[model samples]
Target: MTRQRYRQLRYPLIALALILGLLAIHQYRLYASPVTAQRVQTVTISNAGFLPNKLSVNKGETVSLMIVNTDIRPHNLVIRELNVQSSDLKPNQSATLQFLAEQEGQFPFISNTPGYPEIGYQGTLIVN
Candidate 1:
């Protein structure tokens, strides 16, 4: 509560935020290529394609999809039927989508980006 103490605390908080931002940027650059780094215990979308087209997960398992737009053009990883999708992804950008596979059976996914014909940009989630 003194003015000087408050100022000192603010400086440390700002410094911590800056350091975290820098670390995140560095990590984004490192894993932006392959999309999934060694530390990512989940799936990755590499080269405009889902690394594992068919994912077999158990029901109620927590699944994380680390999707990166490695393609030059913008794209999206969408599972419309499942009502799960990510915002548009620009090249060299990455986003993590975490969901619980609570149901069993096949779930299809595709690139919901417009103007691009649907190619191999599709995948399935096979929950057991």
Candidate 2:
């Protein structure tokens, strides 16, 4: 090729090579990143207390707990160990608590709503 023609193509060739390099790096990152397991569990709150009062998950997994209030009062869920809490949910209302189960142990969750008995409005989260 003539010198003039080579000069005209040089910039575009470099740009194409840079773009391909960037794309290759992006694909490598997507492949090298770890994939975490996601879990969604639904818990219903009623006069009888938390339905399925026990939850279990594996370590390093993401958990999404959907809490639905089906009783005649408002309530909230708290897991101090995991630093997870949900907004007060009125009767027929619902809330979702999301967190990573990084620790492997049994954690207790409870509703701190006034006038509610802690004994009945509590549950255990078992992380393995």
Candidate 3:
């Protein structure tokens, strides 16, 4: 096409491209899996061990746990089944763990911080 025709068609072409891009995004969102809510559950770690240690959530949902280590020594939160482990948080330190609950089952978590587990630093995460 001539330069004049090309220039005249440019705006329409750009508009078409924009519309196509938006349609692609909309289609993707329609076919995509629904996003789970960002819910947070806090657990306090101290001499008393995990407060409300029996955590529960729905399957296919996301799990976000705020682990507050209120003890003088560092502690770790580990879920062997999910291979999820939190850092050895120092005294009064806090950490957050986020993961998808892909499976439905009862998973046990432990603290691998030197006798912490034996001291009652154990809990269960139930995904239904």
Task: Give the clash count for each candidate.
Answer: 0, 0, 0
For residue 80, give model 1's deviation from the true position in Å.
Answer: 1.9
Q: What ranges in model 1 sit over 4 Å off? A: 1-48, 115-117
User: On residues 25-122, what C-alpha lDDT tens digit does candidate 3 reach at each position?
Assistant: 99999889576557899999888888878999999888899999988778989998998999989998899998889999999998997745656888
Report lDDT (CA) for all predictions. Answer: 0.75, 0.88, 0.89
Error of 1 at 73 (Å): 0.9
Give residue 60's error in model 1 in angstroms: 0.7
Q: Which regions of candidate 3 are displaced past 4 Å?
A: 1-37
Among all windows of ten consecutive residues in candidate 1, which has the lowest summed lDDT?
34-43
**C-alpha RMSD of candidate 2:** 3.9
* lDDT score, candidate 1, position 110: 84
* Candidate 2, superposed: residue stretches over 4 Å from native: 1-37, 115-117
lDDT of 2 by residue, 51-122 (tens): 889999988888889999999989888888999988889999998887888999999989888845466899
RMSD in angstroms, all models? 10.4, 3.9, 3.9
**lDDT top scorer:** 3
Ranking by lDDT: 3, 2, 1
